[model samples]
Structure formats: structure tokens, C-alpha cells
Target chain A: MAEIVLEGITKRYPDGALAVQDFNLTIADGEFVILVGPSGCGKSTTLNMIAGLEDITEGTLRIDGQVVNDRAPKDRDIAMVFQSYALYPHMNVRDNMGFALRLAKADKAVINAKVEEAARILDLTQHLDRKPANLSGGQRQRVAMGRAIVRDPKAFLMDEPLSNLDAKLRVQMRTQIAALQRRLGTTTVYVTHDQVEAMTLGDRVVVMRGGVVQQVGTPQELYDEPVNLFVAGFIGSPGMNFLAATLEQGSLRTSLGDLPLEDRVRRRLEGRDVPRDLIVGIRPEDFEDAALVDERHTGHTCSATVDVRESVGSDVYVHFTEEGGPAGTAELAELAADSGRADTGMQGHRIVARLSPATRAAEGSPLDLWLDASRIHVFDPATGINLTHPER
Target chain B: MMSHRNRTLTGWGVVNVLVVLYALFPVWWIVALSFKDPSTLSDGNFVPRKWTWENYHGIFQTSEFTRALINSIGIAVIATTIAVVLGTMAAYAVARLRFPGKRLLIGMSLLIAMFPPISLVSPLFNIERVLGIFDTWVGLIIPYMTFSLPLAIYTLSAFFREIPWDLEKAAKVDGATPWQAFRLVIAPLAAPGVFTTGILVFIFCWNDFLFAISLTSTTAARTVPAAIAFFTGSSQFQQPTGSIAAAAVVITVPIVIFVLLFQRRIVAGLTAGAVKG
Candidate 1:
């Protein structure tokens, strides 16, 4: 219903804790925008600020080019679905859905018509007479959705609304919500902690951390070209493995062996002050199963022992420890849990490689890996910024 | 197979029944006395010498017990009305709004409740004398509120907290002002709590004896508790047995009916509103 723009939006509590700082994002009308981060990352705080639930510490929030920072939440023409549902327990589905219209003093026929239409949309027609206590978790969540839909507000704000449901229901509702948003074509701002939800739901996802926007782009942009190590690791599942080694004698070498970098990437890595702690990042799928003793392969490779291997029918996961590959200081904070990972390989200097079900390997066995050089992410070990080779 | 724990449980159950019997004995006596013949009111046996309706007749037909019961109802109704409105408004503010010195205000309300109210009777009498409203329904209603408001405000405030903030925000987004949200969303969700609070205030206001006795010198403001105490004169030491018994029955029956009607929600509301599971 409206395009929303957040210009230098920030939230600073009275105690001087900045929940969000200098946040800027542009969400087009009829687009689904997701704010995502770990707990205490201020993703939800930012969403609340946009909904008029929290005061903006600085900057302006505009919907349809109208500054709405000082406006009350109701005047902003938004509807929200809460994580807990928060349905009125005393009212039946009909009353719950129609409550806003009734308060607006809409005619009885208009309220009834709107409630019925929303119920039909949500498959809740038969539950019109039932109170929230009588409904199942998924049903109650739908009722919360119905309350918002009936209002036909300018924007829909959802704060992890599916988080409380069981895993299966969460998935089902996630799809339903995305589909509903598409059908309604309302400008929506959603805050979720789950990256998968963010990737799947967002037209433009804003990845936030430490009360700051890390990157704002389409999911494809983030997955393909993350601006920093944090975004690269946080946006992908079984994240990109970050390894440390050094550039020596115009080539990259680790205790494992010397690895060939693309001429273009090599030129970038060998630039001024050659990186002492060069971090090599490769996707799990990018690490192809190979034999260290293979006779033919010569171009691209990294080495780690096969610590543990798991199979999930469709694909096999080989988690291995990097012997002399890159391990020391190349990892991001989330990846730091894998430091010194040599024992169980569950959390340590380990790399998880996705293999075909046909490949087989046992735990604790040393194995060789071939990297798809085109997909490898090379970064400055200290700055964590990607060493992008425009030619490559 | 019975274990040692089962034997202990059975022993505890027996003791619990005995405790319950001790609690019910006085109530059972009052009901029995109300049905006994007026001539046998002083009889010794727990069972009346003859069960007759004559004593009930004496109270219902002769005395002003009915008038006194109506007067008590009127005063309790007025007191509960004033207390519920003020207490709920103040509690909502305390629970949801952030005003300066709110915690201190809440502390003062609790302090008012903690002091024994008997100390305030004379001061209240003086205030009433100055206001020229003593011995009236207004005087009785005023005194009862002091006992009811604190509990109502505290209970209602706790109830307000359990209503998830999302609901209010949703109401706000739906084009309702903050006041409208409180009236529509909060008031409905908190209705059960309000009922529970009302029942508590009603019971306290109805049973208060001191203020009802000292403040009102006439039948116009004398409540059931005060009226019951007047059944005997100091010099004669003679109790109006039938009238007092009949009045007790009238007073307790409504309470029992109320409990029966709202037993489930009231229990749930109390536990939910009080931070209990």
C-alpha cells in the first residue's frame, strides 16, 4: 500500500545503549522486506521502531513520503502479527477479527462482511464461534493473521510470528504468509532470526547485527556477493569455511602444501603488503571429494582430514579438520566455535563438505579436497573484507 | 500393592477431613438455628428439639431483617461501583503507563492497605461530621472503599501485565487511539479479572462491621453486619436468635451462588493474575 524508507533510523535507549544505529533501507511498495539477525542484534528493535512501538533515537521514517516518527501506531496504518499471536482470549474468532472495525464504529453489516471475508481467506470460517483458547496453535496464529487482514492496513508488521509454532507448522505457516503477502501485495516489514526465513520471504532482506545494518540487497546479492565475512557466514547455512594461510614467494602456501590461486585472484591477494593471514572461504558444496594421492588433478585444492561423515539420503556431509590448511585467525566469530576442532570435529577447526551419496569416507581419515576456484571467497585475514577479483 | 506412602496419604486425608469438618460446624449450626422453633432456640442438643419454620417466620414477618438486607445491598453496590472504576483506571495506568514516581505511588497504595483500618474510624467520623453526610449511604460507601480499592488496584494491575503488548499495538495500528485500545482490547481481555476483583471487593464491603457500626447511627446506613450486632441490647444481654440466624442465611446464600456461577473463570483469573501457575 505504501513504499517505506528509513533514513538514518537509529534507536538509543536512555541508558545510552544503541539498539540500532544509522540504519538506512528502502522498501518498495508491494515488496516484502525482512530484518534479520541473531538475538540482541536489534533486528526486532528496529522493526518495533518502525511500527511506532519504540521511539526513534534519530532520523526519519517515511511511509509514502509522509514522515511518521511522531505519529501514533494506529495513525500509521499498519497491522502486526505478534510472535505469541496475542489474540483476545475472551472473544470468539468472529469478534476477534472484527474488533477493530467495531471500534471504528463501522456498521454491523460492514464489520460482519469483512470478518467473514478474512475468515474465508484464512480457512477459519467454521471456527467463527470458537474462542482463542479452543483453537490449536496454528489455528490461533491464523486468527491473528485474520485480525490484520480484515483491517486492510497500509503495511503488515510481523515479528517472528511463526516462531512459536512447532517446526512443521512453522514451515507451513511461513509459506502461507509469503503467499498471502504476495496476493495482498501490501508493503510488509518482517523481522526474523532465522536466515532461511529471511532468504525465502524477503524481496529485499536487510541483514542487521550489533544495531547496525550489515547489508541490504536481494537474497541473491547477499548469497552471491556478501560485502564482509559476517554477511557471508550469517546468510548461508553450513556457512562458508574461513581458513588462514600466508602468501609466500609470490604464491599461497600452508603447511599442507602450496595451492594455486587464479591469476586474477592471485594478483589481488599479492597486492601491497601481501596478506600475512589470508583467509580462504569455500562453500560446503564447493569442496569436491578428492584423493590426496590422485594422479591427475593439478590446479585447485585444499586439505583437511575427514573427521566425521554423515549421510542424509540425498547428500553426504564430510566434516574434516584442516591439518595445515588455514585455521588460526581466519574465522569469523560464529566460525570461532570451530577453533581447535580436532577431536569430535563437531565444533573445531573443521570444514564441512557436501559430497555425493556415491562418495564414501570414514571419520579421522585424512583426505584431499578440490575447490571450485570460481566460488572460493578469498578475504583479508585482518579486515575480513572479500578480496574481489573483478575479472574473475 | 499398597506402600508406606499410601498409608501416610490415607492418614493425611483423614486429618484433612477433620479440619474441614471444624470449618463447617459453625455454618451448619447457623443454618440449623434458622430453621429451629423459636421456643427451642436455647435448647442444648445440637439437633433441635423440633424443627419448625416459626423462627424463620419471626424474622421474615416481624423484624426489619429484610429492610436491613436491602440497605446492606445498596451500600455494597455503591462502594463496589466506585472502587472498581477508580481502581481499574489507576491500575491500568500503573501497569501500562510510565509516569514519574509510579513505584512510589504503588508503595503508598500498599501502605494504605497494610494499616489496620480500625485506627481510621474516628477520623472518618470527624470527616463525615464536617461533610454533613454521616449516617447516610454515602458515609457507609466511603468507608468500605478504603478496604476494597487497594486489593482491586493491585489485582487488576497484575491482570493488565498478562495481556501481551502486541494486542495493544495491534489495536493502535487498527486506527484506535491509546484510550480506545484500553477500553476495547484491554477491558475485554481483563473482564474475567475485573469480575474476580469485583467479587473480592464485594465480599469485603459487605462484611465490613466497624465503619458500618460507628459511622451510621440510623437504619438508613446500618449494613447487615452492623444490623446483626444490634440484635442484643447491652442491659438485657438477650440475643435476637431467630432474626440473627435468618439474616446470616440471607447474606451467605448469594455468596455461594456467586461462587458457583463463576467458580472456573474466577479460579483461573486469580491464579493467572497473581503470578501463580
Candidate 2:
């Protein structure tokens, strides 16, 4: 119902540590925007600043085109669903949902009717009279949502609302939240560290790292054209594989093999100061079993010893080790540390390739893999910037 | 052979009986003393040989005992109410706020709680007299509040810490003002702790004999415990044991009633549903 505009919003703590710096984002009316990053990336702090729970040390916050830097959370007309649910323990589900209306001094009948409608929408009608202690985790989550829905506020701010639920329930509730937002058409700003939630639930996703935004684009755009090494490694499952490579003449000299650059990449690198030492990025799905590849499609091919083969019903993922060392850079090291794989002392550069189910690749066996050279991304070792997609 | 579980049960049963006997024996003696006739008061029997309501009747007939009882109730009630209100605010600030002297405030309260009351009795006596509040309800109530405020703050702050901080933010986001959030959301959730603290403060104020006797000399502000020491018989040569026992029983009834009324609420885990485990 309203567009939330955060213009250079910054949050600097009293200890002089900057939690968020110059954050700027204009959430369009009825658009679902997700702020996603690893832990300590200031995603929640940014959301809190918008909710007025945290003071913005710099810049102005505008809601519906009015500056509300000093307005309280209640005066801002925004509803938030916390990660902990935070349902009032003393009140029953009905009263918890109708609290805002009651606080506004609405008529009793109107409060009851609106609460009933929200309960119906959330499928919590049977639990309206039950205390929060009596309901299941999913039911409590619904009550949290119903509390926000009954207000029909200017926007909804959700901070990892599904994190408390189990994995299966999280997926189920994620779909429900997406559908609910679409049906209500209410502007929502969701903050989460789970990139999958960011990919699936948002019209546009903002990938952040170290309190700075890396990229903001649609899910497909982010997946296909990540602007930096962090976003490329963070966006997709099984993450993009980073390999140490060197660019010389018109090809990339990698540990797997020398890969001839595609015409488009060669054209993009025509007049730029291309670094000799580069980090080559390739998504797992971009690799194929050479035997299953189309005959007419010409692509780079490499032979690797398959260390592990996993069959997940529809496709097979083959993990292997290359002779080259890991593509070590500050950004990739941070990404590895964030994923808890930093000190693993991995033997060699690990590579994962998604292959067709029909391919007969076995563990400890040699297999020929085809790489889609045109989909490959090259990053500068010094700056972590995706050299091929720098304009994105 | 007896089963191990049966033996354990029997052992616990014996221990429970012994504990109950150890706790209730003195209370039984007091009740028996209150019911004894003045002529048989010195018999020292566990049970009263000739039971009578004479001691109760005698104490009630005198306005001195009745006035002292009224004063005890009023002072304890007022002190507990004021102390709890102030303590709840201070505890909330201690639990939630980040101020400069927060640690110092907590330390000071703890220090006051541990301070010996007898050492301050003479100083308080002089201060109260100079302030023109000596021998009055305000004098006793002030000391009672000052001592019990630390107990209230410590107990209530522990309870406040158990409550999730997100609830307050949720309340604000739900369109409640700061005062409304504390009143409606935080206070209700903190009721068990508040009630428990109130009971403790009341009992502390009720049973305090040192201050009660040292601060007040006349019937105007004398509480039951203080007045009990001044009780006399019909003759100066006779002792007032039966009357004193009766007054003690009368004062003990309110404490028992308070515990019985709030026992369930004090034990209830009210924060169960506030957040996920």
C-alpha cells in the first residue's frame, strides 16, 4: 500500500562501530524485497532502522513520501513479525491478533470481525480461543502473521519469520507467506540469511556483505549474472565453484585445463586492463557429462577423477578434486568461513559438476566433463569483482 | 526383599513426616498456649488441659492490642505497595536499559540488602525525630520500605530478565505507546514475580521487631510485634504469655492466607509461550 524509501540510512552504534552504512533502497508499492546476507552483514539492522526500532544515525526515512525520521514504530503504521514470534503470552490468539485494533480504540464488534477474518485467512479460526502455549509451532507462527495481517498496515517487515520452524515446515510456510503477500498485495521487506528464501520469496533480492550491498536484481538476474565473487558464491545452492586461473592471449589457463574464451567474453575484455591472475567461476549446473552432451555443441572438456557421486532422484552431482590449489582470495575465504568450511584443510581445489542421470559416472573413476565456457564468470583476484559482468 | 523403589518411597515418607513434625511442633505449641486458661498457663503441657477462649477475648477487649494490630496491617500494606511499585520500575530499568550507573545501582541495592538493620536503628531514630515523623506510621513505613525495596528489586529483576525483549518491540510495532506496552504486555507477564515480591516485602515489614520497637514508643505507630513485648497481665506480678500467644496467632493468619491465595500464581511459568524453545 505504500512505498518505503530509505535514503542513505546509516546505523552507527554508540561505540562508533558502523552497523549499516549509507543504505539506500526504494521499495515500490506492493513489491516484496528481500535483504539477504550471511550473519553480521547488517540485514537485520537495516530492517530495524526502517521499523524505527533502531535509530538511523544518518539519512532520512520516508514512507508514502513523508519523512518519518523521528516517528515511533506505532506511528509509522508498519507491522513486523519477529523471528521469535513474540506473541503476548497472557492473551489468547483472538486477543493477540486484535491487539492493535483494541489499542486504536476501535469498536469491539469491528475488532472481533476483523480478527475473525484474519483468523480465517490464516486458517487459525479453530485456535482463536486457545492460548499460545496450547498451539503448535506452526500455529503460533500463523498467529504472528495474523497479528500483522489484521492491522492492514502500510507495509510488513518480517525478520526471518520461518527460521524457528523445522525444515519441512519452513518450506511449507515459505510458500504460504509468498502466496499471502501476493494475495494481500502489501509491500513487504523480509530480512533473512537464507539465500534460498531470498531467491524464492522475493520479487527482487539484495545481496549484501560486510554491511555493503553487492547487487540488487531479480532472482534470475542474480543467479545468471552475479556482480561480484561473493554474490556468485552466495546465490545458488552447491555455490559457484571458484578455480584459480590465469588469462593469457584469448584463453583462461586453469588447473582443470586451458579453456578458450568465448567470443562474447573476448569482446568484453577487448580494451580493459585484464588481470593476469583471475578466479574463474562456474556453477555446478553448467557442467555436463561429456557423453551426454549434444554432438554439435562445441565446449571445453576436462577429465577428472570423481571422488563422490550423489544421485538426488532427478540429477546426479559428481564431486572431484583438481590438482590446482583452492582459488584463495579474501572474498572466497570469507564465504568459506561463513559456510563453516574454512579450516577443513581440503586437499585440492574441489569441483562439483551436475550431470545427467543417464551418465554412468562412478566414484574413483575417470570421467570426461563438458564445461559451458560462455556461462563461465571470471573475477579479479584482488577486487573480487566479476570482470565479465562488471556492468551488471 | 523389599523393592528398591518401595524402600526409597518409604525413606522419603519418613523424612517428610520428620520434616513436617519439626516445622509444625512450635506452631502447635503456640496454638495450645493461646487456648489455655490463665490459671493453667504455666502447666507447660503439649495440649491445653482446660481449653478456653479467654486469652483471645481478653486481648480483643483491650483497645491497645486492637490498635496495634490495625497499625501493623496498615503499615505493612502501604510499605509493600509503595516498595513494589518503585522496585518494579527500578528492576525494569536494570534489566532492560543500558545506562552509565546501571552496575553501580545494582551493586548499591545489593549492599543495602546485606547491611545490618540494627546498626542503623539509632541513626534512623534521630533522623525520624528530627524530621518530625517519630512515633508515627510514616516513620515505621519509611524504614520498612527502604529495607524491603532491595528485596523487591532483586526478585522482580530476575523475573523481568526471563521475559523476551522482543515482546516490547512487538508491542510498539503493534501500535502501543511505551507506557501502554509496559502496562498491558510487560506488567501482565511479570505478575507472578510482582506478586511473589509483594508477599515477601509484606512479610519482611510484618515481622520486623527491631525497627518496630526502636522507632516507635507509643501506641500511635506500635505494631503487633512491638506491642507484644509490652503486654502485661491484670496484675503486675503475673505474666501475659497467653495473651502474647493469641496476638502472635492473629498476626500469623494473614501471612498464611497470602501464601495460600497466591501459591499457584507464584509457581506458574507465565513465560512459557512467549517464545519458542
Candidate 3:
């Protein structure tokens, strides 16, 4: 295992476009770090720099405490699994797995033993002689994994390796890859655009946007405590709901209703010139069916016609529209664009609430939703900074 | 309605048979003429009046025909080898690399491919004479290779482009140097395309007549097509039709055999399914 450190790693194209800038991270040994973002955010470029596939523009990259910016990929001793699998079409599974050893001039018996062991681990022992063309998509993916496994390199770099599979196979391979990584205990730097993959696979998720690291934390840390509007919206499914709010006195007024500022937030805002316009963030799970809420707790309540209702066996999600005016900010706009939710002239902001499955919610009917106001987030409208974030 | 479809099928069948005959009749007639008896050489019928081995024997007895056959095989093989090797390198660059003048290089090759070979005969004839290489095998081989290089590059480059570029990256990550990556991975995948290109280049050189006739003056380096033109009968007044036809049939044997032997690979190369959708 190897620990990789990127100190101010930057990638500047010859045409003067900066693809990645000031990228700094220290991956501990055996840590699974995921770099995730939408397309063209330079997540792949950053991974390539670590693998020595792309040249670092103006920073140092160190693997196991040695600077390796000029080292060739083969010399870096890292194995990479590509999005396309990239298996040799002309070679059978056995040969493809043993190719690296053959190149290194390993003994024939050693190569065969290693390849056979990798094949068995991947459950590909029965198809050692089959070419990539004859194998199913999942089988080809496994061969790619087997090829990487046989190398036993210092580290592993994966660039969306499960992207090309169908949804069912993708889920299956996701767990397999995680299990394999844990068993091998290899430090891996994985790049993916899928947030779910980032959440499930990474020991620590590095959320990137516009070629910048917005936050770096464990999946649960990022989910429960996003630092800004972008990370707040990007990490969870049915992403965090945003509403424009106005702060007056010690209370915040939003379209959902007025919520009393918690003592911590009131203290943070005390003796300061607070911004009048704010954006309130609430996650789907923070909302509950009004009837299901405990009588001991005071919950902020709102009423709206349910635009749609989905019963997913475990819970029901109610999608409704509100006149919150889309929480206009640069970060929210970028997040909306990344999620393909921008520029359809959506009349108003859409908010999703996860409630108890027993709730008698139906489409075109008004529903009472009780939100945990104490858990609500307040952000400065201009800067997208979370005003109520404890760490900030 | 079924009868109407049957009539259409019959009409297409007749057309196809006629087309096949139209293409193969000349080759059959040449083979038939090679076996015609000397007495019936002037029969001028579709079917030979008499069959004999006299014409084949007559051509085989001449050292000039045998020498020309050797010249044709040697020159075509050498030219094809050189052209394909150079073409594969150039094609790989054209398919994969981005350089300042790549488009210009492609355009220049296209220009040479379309230029009339006959137009260069006179200048090449003079140049080779000045170089003291005229009527030499080197002279014939040079022009053959030069003209065929463009064809080889175009065909091979198209094949190279179809290869998934990710395989190279995968090889590098698997601990292969650039040279090893090529020898162990890319070269094997490119073999079919290279073999197909070699056959095409050899055929072009083998069938060339304009360059062969203009550049050579005697049997010293004359290829098969040129050698056939120089065949003469026993007497100055007699026609050499039978001998010429026999030589023509003899020269065609190698090409037919090559096509038969590599027909499957040629088809696969042309329609290679290197990458799945």
C-alpha cells in the first residue's frame, strides 16, 4: 500500500484553460478516496496526474513520500482499471491477466500461478481461454479487475470502471469492488460522476465542482454537514431542498413558514450585521408526516398540494411546488445545471419530502408536512456559505 | 401474387448468371486457348475445337518466360514487404497522433494515389536511365513500391482507427514500455490489416504493365506482363497468339491461389469487428 499526496497539483492546458487548480490532498495508506463531480470538472484529470498519465502543470505529486511528477506510468508501479475495461481483445482472459508479469520477465510458473489465483478469486477460472468478445459485459469487467489484481501494484487507480455496465450489474460490481479493495487493502483513487458510487465506495469522498474541491470528508460527514450550497445539494438523493428566506428579528421567514432560529444560530448572528436574504436548506428526511411527529417536539408546519406521490415500500416521497423563487445563487445554478434541472423555465422550485409510508398522501391533494426546523440550514444568499454550519 | 414474386426471382437469377458469365468468360477463354492445338489456333470459337498441351509446353521451354516469372515474384514480394512495413508505421501515426502537418501528409498521399501512372512513365524512364538503373530489377521495384505505399497506408490507417485507443493505456498501466506495448499488444491486433494490405500491394505490383514496359528494354528485368508482349512465334510471319495466351494463363495461377488461400482473412480484415457497440 502507498500513501499519495498531491500538493498544489494543477493542470493547465496549452490553450490557457485551467482544468484543475491547487488540488491538495493526502491519501493515507489503504484509504479509498473518491474524486467525484459532473463531466469536465477535471476529476479524471486529477486521477491521471496521480497515475502519471497526465503531466502536472505546476505542483508536486508524491507517492509513498517520493516526488514522482516525471516518472512514467509503468515506473510508478500503479495499476489502473479504465472505464472501458480496456481488455486486450486478441488475448484470452489468462493471457490478459498475466501480461504484466510477462512484461516484467517473471517466470512462466509464477505467471501462471498468479493468473490462475486471480482468475479463481474473480470467479473467472472457468473462462480462462475465452476472448473478451465472447464474454458477457459483467464477465469482461471481472477480467479487467483480475488483470489489475494480478499485477499487485503499489496502488490502484480506477476511472469509473463500473460505468459501462447495466444498472443491475453496476450495483453487483460496486459491492465486489469494495470488498476486493478491503481484502487487498490497497490505496485506491477512484474517479466517478455518480454520487451514489461516491457515497457507497469511498472511505472519504472528495466532492469537486468546476475543478475545485468543495469538501473532503467521510460520506456520512458530507451528507449530514455539507459546507455550502453546492455540496448540500449534490450529496444526497432527491437532493437537499432549497428555499429563499428572509431573516427578521430572531426568526427566519421562508415560504414553508417561519422557523425560530436555534440558540446556536442566534448566538452566531448576535452582534453582527446579518444579511437579510438567506437560503434555507432542508434534507428530505428532515420532514415528517404531521400526524407521525412526536407531540413533545415542536415542528415547523407547511401546507401544499402534492404534485406527485411515490410509495417506495420503505417510505413515501411527496413532491410539491413552492414559491421559494429557486434559491438564486451561483452555486445553486451550477448544481442545478449539473443535475440537468436548469433552464426548463420551471415555474417555481420543487421540494421533495420523505414521510411515513402510512401517510394518506395523494396527488392533487393538500398535505400537511412537518419539518424539523432545528435541523434546517441557513446560508448567506450571495456567497452560498452555510451561515449555520458549526465548523464554519 | 406468389407466382409474380417467383417470376421476379427468376428474372434476378437470370441477370446474376449473365453477369457472372460476363466477368469470367474472358478468363475461361484464355485458359481454353492455352490448351488449343496449333492446327486449330485460328478457330475463333467460344469452345476450343481441339485441346492439346503443345502451347503450355512451348512457353515452358523458353528460359525467357521462366526468368520473367522469377522477376515478377521477386520484385512484387520485395516491394510489398517494404511498402507494408513503411505503411504500417505511417498509418499508425496518421490514425493516432496529432501533429502540425498530419493533414498535409494525408493529402499528399491521396494526390499520389490518384496521379496517372502513365504520365510518370516518360520522366521515370529518363531518370532511371541517367541513374544507370534502367532495365534493372531495382528500377522496377522502386516505382512499384512508391505507387503502392499510398494504398497500403490508406487501408491500414482506416483499420488502425477502429482499434480502441484505451488498450494502449491499459498496457502502460500493466507495466509495459512503449515498445513492448506495441510488440505484444498493438502489433498482434494489427496483423490482419497488415496482411490484407500486403496482398493488395503485391497484386498491384504484379499486374503493373505501364511501368514494366516503359522502364525495361529486355528480358534482363522484364516482368510477366512485359515478357508476354515480347513473345514471338517460330517464324517472323506467324502469330504468337497461342504462346501469349499460354503465358497469360501461367502468370494468373499464383494470384488465383493467393486469393483462394487468404479469402477468409481478407474478408475478416475488411469487416473486422474489433470493438463492440
Candidate 2 clashing pairs, residues 3+ apart or interchain: none
**DockQ of candidate 2 relative to the true structure:** 0.89
Q: What is the TM-score of each candidate against the true structure?
A: 0.90, 0.98, 0.96
DockQ (C-alpha) of model 1? 0.41
Please give the range of 10 consecutive residues that has the lowest summed lDDT in model 2 chain A: A290-299
- Cα lDDT tens digits, model 3, A1-392, are 89999999999999999999899999999999999988888999999888887899999999999999999998998999888888898888899899899988999999999999999899999999988888888898899899998988889999999998999999999999999999999999999999999999999999898888989999999997788888899999989999998997778898888887866667766665569988999999988888777752555777889999999999999999997677888888888888888867677889999998999989999988888877887888888877776675
Writing each residue's lDDT as its tens digit, candidate 2 over A56-80 gives 8999999999999999999999999
List candidate 3 stretches off by more than 4 Å: A267-274, A295-297, A343-346, B1-4, B269-277
Task: Evaluate every candidate with DockQ and list the scores.
Answer: 0.41, 0.89, 0.51
If ranked by lDDT, best first, what sequence of candidates would result? 2, 3, 1
**Per-residue C-alpha lDDT of model 1 across residues A75-104, encoded as one tens digit per residue:** 787888888776776678898889878877
Q: Please say which candidate is ahead in lDDT: 1 or 3.
A: 3
Correct interface contacts retained, every candidate: 0.49, 0.88, 0.57
- Please report how far candidate 1 places residue A9 from its true position, in Å: 0.4
The better-scoring model by DockQ among 2 and 3 is 2
Candidate lDDT scores, in order, read 0.79, 0.93, 0.88
Comparison by lDDT, 1 against 2, better one: 2
Candidate 3: share of reference interface contacts reproduced = 0.57
Give the Å error, residue A176, model 2: 1.0
Clashing pairs in 3: none
Interface RMSD of 1: 4.9
If the candidates were sorted by their DockQ against the true structure, best first, what order would they fall in?
2, 3, 1
